[model samples]
Target: MDLTVKIKRYNPEKDDAPHWESYEVPADPLDSALALLLHVKWHIDGTLSLRKSCAHGICGSDAMQINGENKLACSVLVKDLVDDSGETVTFAPLPSAPVIKDLVIDQSRFFEKYRSVKPWLINDTPEPERERPQSPEEHEIIEDATKCIMCGACTHACPSTWADPDYLGPAAMLKAYRYTFDTRDDGTEERLDIVDSPDGLWKCYTIFNCNQACPKEIDITRWLSALKRRAVTSSASTAA
Candidate 1:
């Protein structure tokens, strides 16, 4: 089937502002949006730019705004994007971040936020001869949180982060929750303090955009709610 793919294009060196460019490509209905993009890049326009490593969606590098929603281009089928009459599919760079080129946004801010929460296992306890052991129950608690691929979908979908770039956003807060709930991690107190600030978990406003935008199907709102509760309880205990 012939489909029109509209992409928002921007070249910092050439264009003063962004503009829209449309391409008509012969694409299979079963083909992914990324596939259509590849067709355009290979056949139509070699100058078109985007980012993708593992096209299977594990790398989360192809995240972009598709039909006004943040999602992985490799995972979204072209059929799903078309209506009954098969209208055109639109693609744009992730919002709230600097766009480097067509369909690509700078991820430096996203990674900085992720790093702020220290998304790693931190245990000051003395190490035994063998690796630390965790019960099945403990592992299950953080299993869903650990599924996060650090894709900027949730973060870009967040209005708070868009309004205030300093806000920690859902992805970082989710990472904070992941470690805070881990049985082996001993950095809960420190993590809580980091997220208790104005630009942290409290800024979420419970909009639920992060939850809706998560491609991994992870319930990010639930994790943020849990983090909020933990922060409140910790605050109350500290005051008392």
Candidate 2:
């Protein structure tokens, strides 16, 4: 089927503001939106700009607003986008961030939030001769959170983050959850302090938009709720 892809385009050197540019391309029904994008760039316009790597959805680099929702372009099929009365598949850069060019948004702020949460393990204990041991049950607790690829979809979909850029956002909160729940991590209290502020866990309104946007299908809202519960319990215990 031939699909019309309407992409929002912006070039800082030329255009004062972003504008829409449409392209018609022949595509397999099973072809992904990323494939369609490549076709447009390869066949139609070489100047078209977008970011993609590992086109298999593992790298999370091709994230964009597809047909109104934030998704990894490589994971959305063209057939899935067409309706009973075929509509054009629209593409745009992720919301709530500065657009660098066509379908590419600045991610520096997102990474800064992730860094604030300290996404790595902090174990002060002496290194084991072999490796830090963990039971199957312990690993299971954080396995889902560990699946996060830092795609920024959840963060971009978050209304709170859109309203207040300082809000830690779902991606950072999930990272916090991952490390806080880890059996070997010794930074739970410090991490908790980082997320317990106004711009952190408390800012989440439980809208669940993050869960919908996540291509990894991680229940970001659930993890954020769990983090809230842990924060409350920790505060109560400390007071006592």
Candidate 3:
């Protein structure tokens, strides 16, 4: 099948603003969008820039806004995008972030918000003689949230993040939930303090855009709601 890929390009030193560039590719319908991008970079235009650590969708580095939705290029197939309407697929850097070059957006701010949630285990009581163990049931509670690859798709798709960049977006809140709900974690109170702030959890209006953009099929809005309830419940018990 023949596919036309439209990319939004930006060169900080050259163009004052981003612009559109298109490429015509003869490709298999089974080809991934990332595969198409690689084809363009390799054969069509060497200057075309994108980030892809693992084209299998593990790194989530190639996350971009495709057809007006944030998605991992590797997870999106050409056949799905190529309908009778047109065999054209539009690509842009993740929204609400500075464009670096072509399809790459500056993810520094995205990671900053992610780190603020303390995504790692926070048990500071003491080092156990053996690794702290968890049952399948306990791990399953947070299993979905743990699937996050920090793609920033959820955060970029979020209206709250767009309205106010300072707002702690869904990705971070999901990180908060990942550990806060983990029975092995001991920093629930500390993490909740950060998550309960005005610009943090409250900023999310439960729009569910994050849910749709997530490539992992994670129920992000649902997990965020669970975090909200957790904060309220934690605060109430403290008051009592």
In terms of TM-score, the best-performing candidate is: 2
Least well predicted 10-residue stretch by lDDT in candidate 3 = 78-87
lDDT of 1 at 220: 93
lDDT of 1 by residue, 78-173 (tens): 888886436688889989889988787888888998999988988988998998899999999889999898888999999998999989999999
**What TM-score goes with each of the models?**
0.97, 0.98, 0.97
Better of 1 and 2 by TM-score: 2
Ranking by lDDT: 2, 3, 1
RMSD of candidates 1 onward, in order: 1.1, 1.0, 1.0
Error of 2 at 217 (Å): 0.5
Question: Which of the predicted structures, 2 or 3, would earn the higher lDDT when compared with the native?
Answer: 2
Q: Model-by-model lDDT, in order?
A: 0.90, 0.92, 0.91
- Cα error, candidate 2, residue 32 (Å): 0.5
Candidate 2 matches the true fold with a TM-score of: 0.98
lDDT of 2 by residue, 93-163 (tens): 99989998888899999999999999899999889899999999999999999899888999999999889
The true-structure Cα RMSD of candidate 3 reads 1.0
Clashes of 3: 0
lDDT for 153 in candidate 2 is 91
For model 3 the TM-score comes to: 0.97
